[model samples]
Target: MRALRCPVVELRQYTLHPGQRDVLIDLFDQEFVETQEAVGMTVLGQFRDLDDPDRFVWLRGFDDMPRRADALESFYGGPVWHAHRDRANATMIDSDDVLLLRPASARGGFPAPPGARQAPGEPAASPPSLLLATIWYGHGPFDTPFVEFFERRVRPVLTEAGGEPLAYLRSEHAPNTFPALPVRMNEEVFVWFARFADEGRIDDHLNRLRHSAHWSEEVLPAVSQRWARTPQRLRLAPTERSVLR
Candidate 1:
């Protein structure tokens, strides 16, 4: 069977109360998954930020802008959210500033199911974790050369150094339909997710990229010329029930 096409995606990062990240994750995994999907949205994956214990990250997708509106309204307005909204809100310190995104092209989205999962308390090498990178552009729509430059020039190096490219995305242009949940507005960005064998492998891959003349001399110049800010890298580990694992 063909995988579902999730055209519009939200990369949500929540800042939780210091000790409440796990509490929220448990509530989310146990109660939120199937319910949200039933309301016309795809619960792509839920993750724990390996680097930040108090931060929770997850992704959800929709068919299009209008569908996203319908799904959000149905899910958040329904009994499930109403019952658990206060509990969920209590765990979070901040829930706004979400990145609204879409696949860069037809070939630029997530991989199919049977994703690998890292066993709890196990060493990093036991199972691979995903590396999610958010590359911020200067402003507005991304230019063709910038996309081509990354794919043609930067991607090969990452692949050669043990990175498995998953998705290439750009910020979505549609206005936020769910006013209750604010998305980062008018932001220009490109995001990519890749898989690596372990944290060490990601480190090694980045080290190689930095040492290589191609990255430092060629790619750096192009990136510097266009990027609005330094790229943000989030090293994430899939939760036990995460589909993207």
Candidate 2:
């Protein structure tokens, strides 16, 4: 058979069951790392819900549609692939729950920008936790060098400062969009979400950029290169989330 030709890019979100998540998490880690090394594939990232272990999101970018189509059958339909798909397919394979998303840009990271973050002090409800998120759009094309600089310089600043990285997100354009998704979000976008304690911490988190001159020289430019070309960048906080528990 001739190879499939996908004109744009592809984004896929695979949701797993409670019992199946751990198994698939391990599989995806190995699988993603391997896939990132393949031709036309770049920027692989993953996200897991803070409140729920069963819910997770991952993003990967492909240069062409043909490789993307062949990849679907190639990855999931392969011999070892059943371990991840078989369990979920038994439940809600076609449900709106499991999906491939193409945001307006490529970075379908975070909660899609709730836009309204509650004030610092509000009436206390049970389990008071402020979900702090910062989503970045990758515009730079220098994948290998950027990842290295990140590992050596940027990532340390984050970890050293007590920031919890929820996920690193990357995506490809999807020709189709679901009713839940905005139609304009049909292009490549890259993003990642992280949570913080509260307002002061969130403020300080942004301030970290100023402290790291080394980080600035070595890292920021790398990410900026990837982000500049992307169409959109989402920066949002939820005043109230349904608490995807």
Candidate 3:
């Protein structure tokens, strides 16, 4: 299947109860994937946070704001979620850390995976590539200048340093259509996703960026001045059925 184009996306991070991450992942992979897609949404990827065992991270996309509202209404009110909601809710301590975003530019969106996603009931295997999700919190929305700066300066540096840029996104100011599931409001963020071969590659990539004087002396200072706080970095391993890996 061709990858769906998701102009709007959600980066959802759930803090789960200890030892319950796997339980939720299994249920999500089996029950949530196809059902959501049936309702006009794309389950882009699901992952385990390598740094935090109790955290469950996932990405889902929508065609636009109106469609996002419609899809959530259908899936959340439908029979599947109703049947499994309790079990899923039981595993979560918190599920409200969500960021709504849009592609930074015309071409800044996820590409189709090289192969088909693993079928349901197939044994889970270790994914060879690691995904990195980096978020930069800013005082105000990242405007055209910052976006251009990233595309022209920061992105090339990352590519040269061996990270494969998957997507670059900034906050979507659309109102929260579905009130049942609250998203972080009044926040400004810039997020980028990348892939590396493994942990070793990630380390090497970081080392290369750090050693580059242009990055340290030029790009780093400009980025620091624009964002309010330290960026959040997530090291993610794709779940068995994830297409991104």
Candidate 4:
């Protein structure tokens, strides 16, 4: 697997006004992708949340925390954002549902896609691949033991069951250096991402895990005990410019 060059990542979920998702996505794909990268961050992926038509989810990464701050300062302060901010903001109901995260393991960050991302105005791939993002919220911080548990026990089961692990990330507890763009500060979460060629593969993978004795008897019990709430699973379809697909 290719190693992620950007250690600092953001999982951004925006709730937009009804019927405005495509509008914002068009604007974002056209204006945001390369411009943000030019300012020193990677636009990892952009997706349309399958469960919520009005919601848009995306990821971006930076070299580290300090660079994250610098990049955000530059991009948000730059002329492009200034010119487009109003139109972009008009499509949103809320943009603050953000999560700050870092790789849970040394090689857990998302790898580069096998193919190049599409240029502006390029059409989305026909029947884009499906991406699964599972978020596990915890009452308290995910301690070292939990991270180890996931890496050693849970991950193997996932891979063995047909899930292609894309990334494993835990809550980044750093103070929000760019306070203008807020993140979920009071919550603790562990999130993992996987990719599938199609919906059938996802179902097959889940069925395998559900039937596995180890997964059902051992993993489920431990996860339920540690979990603060039920996990959030997002089924996402990549936009044309997404690199994570």
Candidate 5:
């Protein structure tokens, strides 16, 4: 496969078993929701390995070369990160390595032009877009508070991250999917996509989201204890534009 030149470069690391994924989530959620925003970490994407159980992944970005380099330096070397880094490192198995994702839509944003622009009377063109998805089961009663969080917190954070307000949708309603790693989708999965002016905007949009104020406090409280057991996340860059726009 070709290396995608997505505008948003998602960076992640997957730790192995005997390692507590939820424990890591708990210990790092603050740094995740908070520090990422502060450190100028661009996108804060979360996910579960569909095929590999308990394999969790996170996605975030940087717009330019300097910002990307700076965020990494701050995350790995800053004093604010020391404790969380220690905890995450201590809890994980050695096999895990960080992964990067840049959806095709975003890739179009590279030095390459994102195809052609619309003609004068032609239907408005649908620019390529990418959706970051999180799937987890709704354990009955937790639904109310969770719903509330989705409305009040999650949406705004996503809006801020994207730098554009994207219409939110359900997995079934939106129904856009790529080959996911592997996991049972029983939970109240939430889906949202960010549209770019061109494919390249994807990375810039994500970078802004990591810097958003609401990304952490908005979603972290609702994260359940069992979250570690089912940390599923995936990203899809749609090949065909959905008619919803």
Candidate 6:
């Protein structure tokens, strides 16, 4: 298992000025990865929203809460960001209110990137696109039993429905460090991102899952009782340069 170097994570969803997603992805993939990691953060993975052309979703990590402040201060204050921040900001209509997170357990963090973060001008790897489903539970502090239930029950249901579970994560409860860039405060949520072959397959899978006796008899009851609200779902596809693909 790869060590989860970053105990603190940020799930950032950005609403871009129409058709500017690729423009920002180009800047991000070309210039942002190693530069931020050079200071202290890990650029985990970047993705394109298959359902929405104007949305970009990415993850970044830090060793701990304090480190998050130091890393952001350094990277955003550094020359690369200074030179490119305007362009990046220009692409986005909104970038704040990210989900602050950490690994649910020791083994719950992201897999290491295939190689070291790519430098500018390096050829990025081309991996097949996978349908990423992010299900966000409105309440969190999802404990051992809940995680076990998800893996043992919900995951198998999703698998049977043609969705492959990729990662499961819970909200990080650490105090906000860089208040300037705020995460949703006082929220308790766990998120799972899974992969499917296509949108039609996902629709089919959900239908099957709904009709499955086990899902109706046990899974739905457990989930409804645990989660505070209906789980919010996001359909994401990898960008050409995304590592998670």
Q: Estimated TM-score per prediction?
A: 0.90, 0.40, 0.95, 0.95, 0.40, 0.88
Per-residue alpha-carbon lDDT of model 1 for 5-86, expressed as tens digits?
Answer: 6989999999999999989988997789888989999888888888899999999999988888899999998999999999
What's the true lDDT of residue 245 in model 6? Answer: 65
Q: List the residue pairs that clash in candidate 6.
A: 140-188
Lowest summed lDDT window (length 10), candidate 5: 173-182
> Ten-residue segment with the worst summed lDDT in candidate 6?
117-126
Worst 10 residues of 4 by lDDT: 119-128
Error of 2 at 126 (Å): 6.5
What residue pairs are clashing in model 4?
A: none
Q: What are the per-residue Cα lDDT tens digits for candidate 2 across 118-234? A: 222443233334443344444433244444565566667666656554444434334532233222343334434456655566567667756767557866665666564533322
- Show where candidate 2 strays beyond 4 Å: 1-126, 138-153, 177-182, 229-241
Q: Tens digit of lDDT per residue, candidate 4, span 1-245? A: 46665688999999999999999999999999999999999999999998899999999999988888999999999999999999999999999999999988777888766777778878755447989999999988887888889888998989999985788898998998889899998888999999998889888999999999989998989887878999999989998888888
Ranking 1 against 4 by lDDT, winner? 4
Q: Each candidate: how many clashes? A: 2, 22, 0, 0, 21, 1
Cα error, candidate 4, residue 205 (Å)? 2.1
lDDT of 5 by residue, 65-97 (tens): 456556667666767667666677666665324
Query: Which regions of candidate 6 are displaced past 4 Å?
Result: 114-126
Instruction: Flag the better candidate by TM-score, 2 or 5.
Output: 2
Name the lDDT of candidate 3. 0.90
**Of 4 and 6, the candidate ranking higher by TM-score:** 4
Best by TM-score: 3
